[model samples]
Target: MEVLEAIWGLLAVALLAFGLYCCYVKYVHLKYDYIPGAPRASFFFGHLPYFWRKLKNKEVAHDLFIQWAEEHGPILRINYLHKISVVILSPEGVKEYLMLPQYPKDPDIYSMFFNIFGVRFFGNGLISDPNHERWRKQRRIMDPAFSRTYLSGLMGIFNEKAEELMKVLEEKADGETEVDVMSLLRRVTLDIIAKVAFGLELNTLHDYQTPFPRAVDLIAEGMTKIRIPFFQYIPWNRKKVKEIQDSLRLLRRTGEECFERRRKAMLNDEETPLDILTQILKSEAQEGGCDYDSMLDNFVTFFFAGHETTANLLSFTIMELGRQPEIVAKLQAEVDEFVGVRRDINYEDLGSLQYLSQVLKESLRLYPPAPGTVRWTGTENVIEGVKIPANTALNFNTYVMGRMERFFKDPLIFNPDRFGKDQPKPYYCYFPFALGPRSCIGQIFAQMEAKVIMAKLLQRFEFQLVPPQRFKVLESGTLRPFDPVVCRLNLRNPLGF
Candidate 1:
C-alpha cells in the first residue's frame, strides 16, 4: 500500500511538469500571433511537423517557404518551437536588413557548423565566424589569393582540369551509356580545387574511390542531419552520427597533414607556388604566431567551399542545357565563335562567351547552391508594414526571392534572355552570391572556373537528359539536384579528333 502511494505521487509530478511545458509553448505561440504565417500544426511542434513532412516527401523546405510567402505576402514568420524566424522575401526588407546595416550572423544557425557530431568542423572559420571585425580581418588576409592577377594565372590550371574532364567524358560519350554527369562534374571540381588551392593532385576525375570526395559527401549529409532536433541523440541515428564524426576526423586530419608539409617546405626555403596554401601560411606569419587550429579551420573551409558550389552550378547548367535545345545551340554558337576549336581557352575567350555567362546567371537565379544567409536582429524593426520583434532570426533566401512572381516574369520559366546585355538587372532581388559587405568573396573565382569547364563541355559534347529524370533539388546543406542528372552524350566534333 505504501509502494502504490509513492508511485502515484511520482506520476502526479510528471503530469504537472507536462502541463506547465504545454502552457509555455502556448504562451510563446500567442506572443507572435501578429506575424503572418501558416497555422501551427501543433501548439508544441509549431511548423516543424509540416516542414518535416515536406522534407520526408522529397520536397525541399524552400518550396514550402515560397508557398507561405505567396499566401501570406512578402514578410512572414515561422516558428520552430520557441525560436521564431522572420523570413524576408521583399527587396526592401532585404536591402534594409542585409545591405544597410551589418547585422551579425545568427549564432544559433552558424554555431551548428562549429562542431558536428562532437567533431570540430569550420570552427570560427571565415564562413562560420559571426564576429564582424574578425571575419573582416580573415577576409582581408585571404583576398590576395583571389585577386585578378592570381586568378588569371589559375586559368591554366582550370583549363587543364577541365580538359581532363573532357577526356574522361569522351571515354563514355558513346551516345548510349547513361553517364551521371553530376558525379563527373563534382570529381573534376574537386581535382581543380585540390590542385589550385593546395598544389595537391587529387586526380579524383580518374579515380572514383578517393576518400576525400566521400568525406565531403558524408560531411554534407551530417550538416543536414544536425538541423533535425534531437537527431544525434536518437538510437537509430547512432550509425549515421558515427559516419559523420569519422568523416570530420578524416577531413581535419588531412588538413593538419597538409599544413605540416607546407610549413616544413617553408622552413627549408623550398620554392612554393603563390597558391592559396602559401597565402594561408603567409597570413599566419603576419599574425605573429602559429595558430594551428585556426589554420586548419581555414584549410577545411576553403577545401570544401572552393569546389562544391561551383560543381553544383555546372551540374544545374548542364541539366538545363540538356532540357532546352535552343539554349544549348546559343551557348554552342557563342563557344564556337569565341573558342573555335582552340585547345586552350584564354582569358579573352572567357570574356566573349557572353551567352554562356547569361545562361550561368540564369541557372543561379533558379538554383543557387548556397541558397540563403541568416542574420540576427537585436532591435525591433518594421518591414513591409509588418512588425518584427527584437531577438528574431531573419532569413534572406535568393531561391525563394527568385521564384516570386513580383521579382521575375513567369518565374518558373528558364529564360537566359532575362539576363541579356540590354535587360535591366533585377533590383536588389537577385543575389545568388548574396549582397552587402559579407557577400561571398570567392564569387568571381567560382564563376571563372565554372565558365571554363562549361565552355569546354559545350564545345565538345551534345548531351541529352535521360528520360524519367526528376529535376528535383536536394537541400543537403547546399542545394544540388536530387537526381544524379544522368545524360547520354555525343561528341560534337568527331572528325576533329
Candidate 2:
C-alpha cells in the first residue's frame, strides 16, 4: 500500500511539470502574436512539423521561405519553437538591417557552428567569430593577402591551375563521353585554393581517391545535418554522426600537420611564400601567443570558404551555358576577341570581358552559392511599417529577393541583359557577397579565378547538357545544383584559341 502511494505521488509531480512547460510555451506564443507567420502546427512544435513536411518533399528549404514571403508579404516571421526569425524580403528592410548598422551575427545560429557533434569546427574563425573587435583585428591583419598587388601576382598560379583543368578536359572532350562538369570544377577549385593559399600541392583533379576532397564533402554534409534539431541524438543517425565526426578529425589533423611544417620553416629562417598561411603565422607572432586551435580554425575556414562557393558558381555558369547556346556564343565571341590565340590570360584580359562579367553576375543573381546572412537585433525596431520586437533574428536572403517580382522584372527568367552595360543596377536588391562593413573579403579573388577558368573553357570547348536533366538547386550548407550537371564536351571547331 505504501509503495503504490509513492508511485502515485511521483506521477503527480511529472504531470504538474508538463503542465507548466506547456503553459510557458503558450505564453511565449502569445507574446509574438502580432508578427505575421503561419499558424503553429502544434502547441509544442511551432511550425517544425510543417517545415519537416516540406523537407520530406525534397524542396529546397529557402524556396519555402520565398513562398512564405510572397504569401505573407515582405516582413514575415517564422518560429522554430521559441526562436523567432524575421525574414526581410524588401530592399528597404535589407538596406536598413544589413547595411546601415553593423548588427552582430545571431549567436543562436553561428554558435551552433563553433562545434559539430562535440568536435571543434569553426571556433573563432573569421567566418564564425562573433566578436566584432577580434574579427576586425584579424581582418586587418589578413587584408594584405587579398590586396590587389598580391592578387595580381597570383595570376600565374591561377593560369597554371586552369591550364591543368584544360588538359584534363582535352583528354575527355570526345563529344561522346558524358562528363560530370560539376565534379571537375570542384576538383580544380580545390587544387587552386590549396596551392595558392597554403602552398600545398593537392592535385585532386588527377586523383579522385584523395581523402581530402572526401573529407570536405563529408564536412559539408555534416554542416547541413547539424541544422536539424537533435539529429545526433536519434538512434538511426549513429553511423552518419560517426562519419561526420571522423571527417572533422581528419580535416583538423591535416590542418595541424600543415601548420607544423610552416611553423618549423619560420623558426629555421627558411624562405616562405607570402601566402595566407604565412599571414596567419605572422598574425599569431604579432599577438605573442600561439593559439594553434584558432590558427586551425582559419585554416579550415579558408579551405571551405576559398573554394566551395567559387566551384559552385562556375558549375552553375556552365550549366546555364549548356542550355543556352546564344549565351555560349556571346561568351565565345568575347573570349575570341580578347584572348585570340593566347594560352595565358592575364589580369588585364579579365576587365575587357564585359559580357562575360554580365553572365557571371546574372548567374549569381539566379544561384548564389552562399545565399543568405543572418543578423541579430537586440532592440525593437519597425521595418516595412511592421513592428519587430527586440531579440529577433533578422534574416536576409539574396536568393528570395533576387527571385521576388518586387525586386526584379521577369525574375524567374535567366537573362544576362538585366546587367548589360546600359542597364540600371538593382538598388540594394542584389548582394550575393552581402554588403556594408562585413562583405566578403575574397569577392574580387573569387571573380578573378572564375573569369580565368571560364574564359579558357569558352576558348576551348563547346559543352552540351545531358538530356532530361533536372535543373534544380540543392541547399547543403551552401547552394549547388541538385544534379551533378553532367555534360558532353567537344573541342571548339577550328580551335579559336
Candidate 3:
C-alpha cells in the first residue's frame, strides 16, 4: 500500500509538469495576440480546433488564410498551436520575404517535407533542403540538366508521350463518354518524366496498374494525411499509414535499382542517354560524391516535381478552356495557325504559341501547384508598421495573392488576356512558380512540356465540361482538381482543312 501511494505521487507530479509546459507554450503563442487574427477557439488549442474542423470538411488551410487576410489585412498573425504564423498577402511583403536570401525556408515546416511517415521522401534534396550553401551547390550542379539546350533536345520524347495521351483521349472523344482528363494527363506526364528524367519507360499512359504510379499516388496522398496529428494512432488511419510506408519502401527500392543500373552502365563504358539521371549521377561523381540516400532523394524529387506540377497546370487550363468557350476558339485558332497538320511539335512551335502561354499563365494564377512557402524570420522586422517578431514562421501564398482584387482586376474571372503581350505584367504579385533564387528550377522544362501537350490538344479536340462535376481545387501538396477534370471531347471540325 505504501509503494502504491509513492507511485501515484510520482505520476501526479509528472502530469503537473506536462500541464505547466502546455501552459507555457500557450503563453508564448498568446503573446502574439496583439498582431490581429481570428478569435481563438480555445486557449489551450489555439486555432487548431477551428483548423481541424475546416480540414475535416476538405477545406484547405489557404481558405482560412484568405478569410483572415480579409479580416486582419495583408500581414496578419495567427496562433498555430505554440507557433505564431504570420501570413503575407501583399505583393510587397511577398517580394520582400521571397526575393531576399537573408530569409531562409522555415525549418519547422520544410523539415516536415524532408520525410513522409518517417520515410525520407525528399531528404536533403534541393526542394526540401534549408541549408543555403548546400542547396546552392546542388542547384548549380543540376542546372545544366534543365538548360534550354538539353530541354530542346527532349522535344521528341515530349511529343511522343503527349501524343500517347491524345490517342487515349481520342478513343474517349465520342461526344458522350465522360472521361477524366486529369487522370489521363497525369499518366502521360508520369510517362514523360520517367522517360526524360530516368530513361525509364513507365508506359503509365497505356497502363495504370503499374506499381510505380500506384506508389506515387499513395505517397502524394500520405504527405497530406501525415500532417494530421495522431494519425498513426487512429485505427482508420493505421491502414493508410502502412500503405504509405509500403509505397515509400517501393519507391526507394526502385530508385536504388535505377541508380545501380545507371552506375554500372557508366562503369562498363556503355552508351547512356544524356538524361536527368545521368546529370545527377555525374553530379555525384564530381565534387567528392553524394551518398545513395541523397541520390534517392533527388530521384524522388525530380520524378514527382518534374511531372506533377505541369500535369496539374495543363489539367486546370483544360478545365478553364471548357468553361470559357470563346477562349477555346481563340486558342484553337492559334494552334491551327502555328501547328497546322504537324504531328510533331518542335521547340520553335512551342514559342510561337504565344496565346497558349497567356492561357497557361492565367490558369496557374488560379491554380498554382505548391501555392505557398514558409520562411523562418532570422531577425525582427517591421512590415508596413507592424512589428514582426524574430523566429516567427512567415508564409507567402500565391493562392491568396492571386485572388486579391488589388493585384488583378476582377480577380475571380479566368481571363487569359491579362497576360497579353501588350499588357503590362503585374509586379511581384503573380508568382505561380514562386520568385527569387529559390524559385522552381524546372519552370522552363515544365512550360515547354505544357505548351507541346496543350497545342496538340487544341489542334485535335473540342472539350465539353461534363455536368455534376465540381471544378473546385483541392489543396494537396499541389492544387489539383477536387474532382478530376471530367469532359466529353469531340474531334474538332471532323474534316481536315
> Which one is best on TM-score?
3
**Per-model root-mean-square deviation over C-alphas:** 2.1, 2.1, 1.9
In order, what lDDT does every prediction score?
0.86, 0.85, 0.84
lDDT of 1 by residue, 428-447 (tens): 79999988877887888898
lDDT of 3: 0.84
TM-score for candidate 3, please give it. 0.95
User: How well does candidate 1 match the true structure in TM-score terms?
Assistant: 0.94
lDDT per residue (tens digit) for residues 1-497 in model 3: 99999999999999999899898877886578778778888866778777788767877768787788778888877776567788888777777888998888888888887888787898888788888887777777778888888889889888988888888888888999989898888888889989988899999988889889999999889887877778878988878888898998888888899989999999999999878888767876785676567778878887878788888998888887877889988998999899997889889998889999999999988888769888888898888678888888998888888888878889889988999989988878888877898888889989998999999888999888888667788777788877778899899855762
lDDT comparing candidate 1 with the true structure:
0.86
Instruction: Rank by lDDT, highest first.
Output: 1, 2, 3
| Per-residue lDDT value at 235 in model 1 | 99
| Sliding window of 10 residues with minimal summed lDDT for model 2 | 283-292
* Weakest lDDT window of 10 consecutive positions for candidate 1: 287-296
Encode model 2's per-residue lDDT on 43-96: one tens digit a residue: 677777876776677667777777787778888777666566888887887787
For model 2 the local lDDT of residue 124 reads 85
The residue pairs in collision within model 3 are none
